[model samples]
Target: MAYRSQIRGEFIRRYSECKAAYLETSWRMIHERDVKHRALNTEFGYPEPDGSFGIGCKSSVDQEYKRRYDEIESRFRKPYDDQLPALHRWALENSMSVYECLLMDDIWDDDLKALAKLSTMEEDWQFQPIIAKARFMVARWKEEHVVGEIQRRVKIESSHFHYAAARCRNLLGLKPWDLAAQKAIFDYGKEWKSALEFAFGSLTAA
Candidate 1:
């Protein structure tokens, strides 16, 4: 019995090591792809007026950027699409789901939620509670990390101001005045104030 316990402990340790290695490799690949994508976007002058590429006409620069973006995106997706099935199978063999495995690896709850959607793991009743928990965890995380940081940087950019206020509005369903006064203490000029008024008006109308 003692030998069996020792062997079980060793197996657990090895499994944890393998899981950590897999997560590290996967995250590194993703991070590298993101960096490349951002660099390519900078080269192509992304976030055109319409928030899309080829605003005026498809220049060679635009085409090259698009090609690189597509390539990187494809490479990023390949591991998830190709390896996920095998991973899922392994998880199932261990009486777990891929979502469970990701959770065990301490992946962000939002990412797990996305994976759950992509994998169509919603069909399982067991997965529903995990999804709910993930949502709660994400909200708590955003409240703790994102909301506070954005509030601090509200004066840095109009986008940051809008994003911080929007988070409060969307997450907590607070009124714009309350969100602006409490979360984002920004002294908006006429344009932003007018825009916010229009946005709030539209929301109230809707």
Candidate 2:
């Protein structure tokens, strides 16, 4: 296995390359389809956008368009979708967490530094990293998927941070949140304070 950061970088690079290839293929297929449509319209005397045509000829053109659309999707898109599973498997084999694989780019740089600091800090050894990681995950969750009114309220409620953090910590098989854990994460340093401002709306509280 390679260094973890190297593995991560490679995964992102390959994934981006795959996406770029798919987009290029898709655009080429679309252009080809458009040219074919224009040629068909000329050959069959199908009506232009501003012209009228017989219902029978229009129906024939619609069927031809559908067939070409399906052909392009299968030929240009399915291979890219199939390649995605292999990339996911590589990420799993390298011991990268789901969060690391999916949201690594989305995580703020300062929050990453705060997590690094918590990992190395000796003071409040047990709670420092755990609470911070859990809370950050909760924050990211809200950012990613908070779409409904209930979810919005849950994200902003005064006590919801503790509740969400505690639940996330439990899912990771860690102890519950407490005042000490909170302080250790938010009050330890500027890195953590910045992270807290990100997780919650501001630095006021969490």
- Model 2, runs deviating above 4 Å: 1-7, 51-57, 61-96, 104-206
How do the residues 1-206 of candidate 1 rate in per-residue lDDT, one tens digit apiece?
11111112222333444455566778888778777776676566775566654322233456776677787778878885555455444544654322233233434434444443433443322233323333444344445565445333323433444553444344333455674334222432223333433433343355
The all-Cα superposition gives candidate 1 an RMSD in Å to the true structure of 19.2
What TM-score would candidate 2 get against the native?
A: 0.36
Flag clash pairs in model 1: none
lDDT of 2 by residue, 1-206 (tens): 11123223334444445444545765676666556555555656677577743222243347765565455445645655555456445545655432233223333544555555554454333333423643665566566664354245434543344444443334333343454444432332333333344545532243
